[model samples]
Target: MTVSKEQIAAFYSTDTLAGDRMAGIDGLRHTGIATFMRCPHRTALKDVDIGILGVPYDGGLTTRTGARHGPREVRNQSSLIRRINVATGARPFEAARIADLGDVAFTEVFSPATALPEIEAHVRAITQGGVLPLLVGGDHSISYPSLRAVTENGAKPCALIHVDSHTDTWPVFQGSKFHHGSPFRLAVEDGLIDPKRTVQIGIRGGQNITDGLDYSRDSGMRVMMIEEFDDVGWKQAAAVAREVVGNEPVYLSFDIDALDPVFAPGTGTPEPGGITMREAQRFLRELQGLEFVGGDIVEVSPPFDSAGVTALNAATLLFEMLCLMTD
Candidate 1:
């Protein structure tokens, strides 16, 4: 295909032509009201292939409170994103029936304990309605309920691709098992996630207890701690991830804490040495062909974020995941 100056000119001129399939009537990427990737903001999930849902409940945050604001900031920052994947040639919005389904509704928003079932119900509706959700964070705790919805309603337990600095497999936290530190553990116990088939990447930092670490090892999940990740590198680590998840329907859960403080400083629990944003993007891109039933980017505490660094990185990662979802 030869490049045409006329078509290129028209793309940036004013609006779009009738046959402009690339962006359709969405207008300029930076001009429109921002939804996730500027897809139409719709409340109904009917006939939608992918729903960009937001779980803006961070009641489980024992360290910091601002992750409750992640979804809004991510949505705002996503307006700067343009269609088409630079490396993989993926035009996600063009390829899928995607829309911003807005945030998940909860009856009592302040309590993480009360929020689990509501989040699960929201995800259950999305999954049952045949909509794959690309959720933005309230916090990592949302993963448990979301996974529960997927695994319980789908054909079987989901294989997880959890990218975080913490294993989050603790048996309990501060008298609550539903808190951020224990979602994966709860999921594993409830059979919502297949521990043997799961692969947790970018795990680093120290913890106060060995219970979670011990449980992760005993449960037989592939855990690539930061040092091991350094030895093998992200490419090989991604290959190992693919091998673990195999052909199962996978759920990708990313905590901003998985990123080094330099790349994403706004997370509730910041780890010293972790993957850079670029490496994270590259690794996520590597999962392009897998069966992604659902995914999320969590723990972006915009209140603590520096000059859009963390939120922008989160938005970009969401874009990468969106490309894979389209694939």
Candidate 2:
């Protein structure tokens, strides 16, 4: 095939209003400074130079190592999908003002004990301004604080839709009550989330033997195992989710380990039999019409990743969630 000059010119064009800024079909406008304030190292790596924010805090990891570096790795490989509005023909930024909002600020490095409160404060400021927060990395524990902030301003408890490989409802781990494995339990116990309106999808791992299953059931949370998911399919699952959540505000929390290790190996916890990338996409796309308050993509450990595949997948999933919210 021969290249055409006209096509080349269209692809290489710059924006006049943006003045020396790169232009794309999506017409995305970068605004706000919340992300840069979260983590300077990650902000510089992703948003400052590359026009993206990659957060890499993994202190909440319970099973594996190096999830703290997830943001950096995911951003490095996220360039694969540079073109915007490629899926739904709707520009996300145009629909609603969006920004990276960076990673949660950790008071003490690798100290889940101190990080939760800090994350709550950061997200509260973002939501207060009416800007939709798109958070990356750290771990599933990060969502607990984010949820607390979202509902802080007199908002009632919202439905929670968690896509993960583990239930993450353990009462406590070691001597710490704030581990990644126990965020949901803390949230529900604290009245930040409604367990009756909550659903945990794609849970299939050995941790079930260690009280994960028991805790989820006792807490009144709906658990949709991966084996059952294979039997019923995502469309039916989405219908069930809609039925449970109704018209209330909702939060979508995605842990990369919810996906099969082959699809997302660079996570704190890797399970063999998990949701495929396609199934995950189908599940997320089905939430198009729901009233989503906020969302997060967590647990991307860059050290274990080969060629940044896991981070790229995480970033793409974040983009898809954004599309669902804005579309």
Candidate 3:
């Protein structure tokens, strides 16, 4: 579908912070308030189909702490994004009523225990409004709460399409069960997702123990390590993901660490021998027709990023994900 002139005008004019500097598509990409591809910022979800939200809390980190800055850097890099997808000609802006809902407010940024509830509440509000949420996260830990919110307190379980280096199914770390490495496990325990219907891709790297790995296998999740991904190829992998999820309500969670450190070194836990950016794109594109209730791109640490490449890649992938929803 063509992006109407009215849509372009509304999008460019939506960010009032720029104050007349941006009036059309001719406006500078770098000069506006960075709101997820320069989309209009709206707190109220009236008539909104998709809400791009930022969860900027990283208190659940087990190691690196820089992912708290992920959302802002991603937004800045997302300014370079245009409205159309060159690969599939998907015009998300025209296909969906999308807006940048801005970042989730945290009253206790330093406490994951308290802050996580805030994440749940915020996302719950979005879903309750009948809007599909596309969240930009602070870390993988945010997924636990996000799943709870998206599934309506686990009353409705969804299939999962998880792309990450680690299974993130480990038990408590340092007496903390809410760390980034355990969100999926926590989600499963709470019945937020169907483990048999979940597909975890691009899992590689050695671990301190086999608990998370064993848990993922024992729980009946389709764990495709990087080796299997290499053997079966992305197309086949995409096929498995599609077959497993079927037509169920699905949530796609992409941890930047799923990409090789060379492609995404800005993550807190960078794993080598992961998938390439091209492979990631193709895999996501293959997931076009699935019913996605919500999705997130997490673990983008701008401080560790070299020349903002990671954030740029994340922004591009975010666009790809948005295209999937549009499809």
Best by lDDT: 3
Model 1 CA deviation exceeding 4 Å by range = 1-29, 153-155
Candidate 3 Cα deviation (angstroms), residue 310: 0.5
lDDT of 2: 0.71
Best by TM-score: 3
Candidate 1 C-alpha error for residue 256, in Å: 1.2
Clashing pairs in 3: none
Query: Could you tally the backbone clashes for each prediction?
Result: 0, 8, 0
Better of 1 and 3 by TM-score: 3
- lDDT per residue for candidate 3 within 172-247, as digits (tens), equals 8899899999999999999999999999999987887699999999999999999999999999999999998988
Question: What TM-score against the true fold does each predicted structure earn?
Answer: 0.91, 0.82, 0.93
Candidate order by decreasing lDDT: 3, 1, 2
Which structure is stronger by TM-score: 2 or 3?
3
Top-down TM-score ranking: 3, 1, 2
Flag regions of model 2 displaced more than 4 Å: 1-20, 23-55, 82-87, 153-155, 208-210
Error (Å) of candidate 2 at residue 251 is 0.4
lDDT of 1 by residue, 1-327 (tens): 586999788768866322223234545556645577666777777868998898898988879789989988998887777777788899888898888888887888767667888998998898889999878988889998898888874347889999999999987668878778888898888888889999899887787888888898899999999888888887998999999999999999999899999999988999898898888988988898999989889999999999878988999999899899999
lDDT of 1 at 43: 76
Q: For model 1, how many clashes?
A: 0
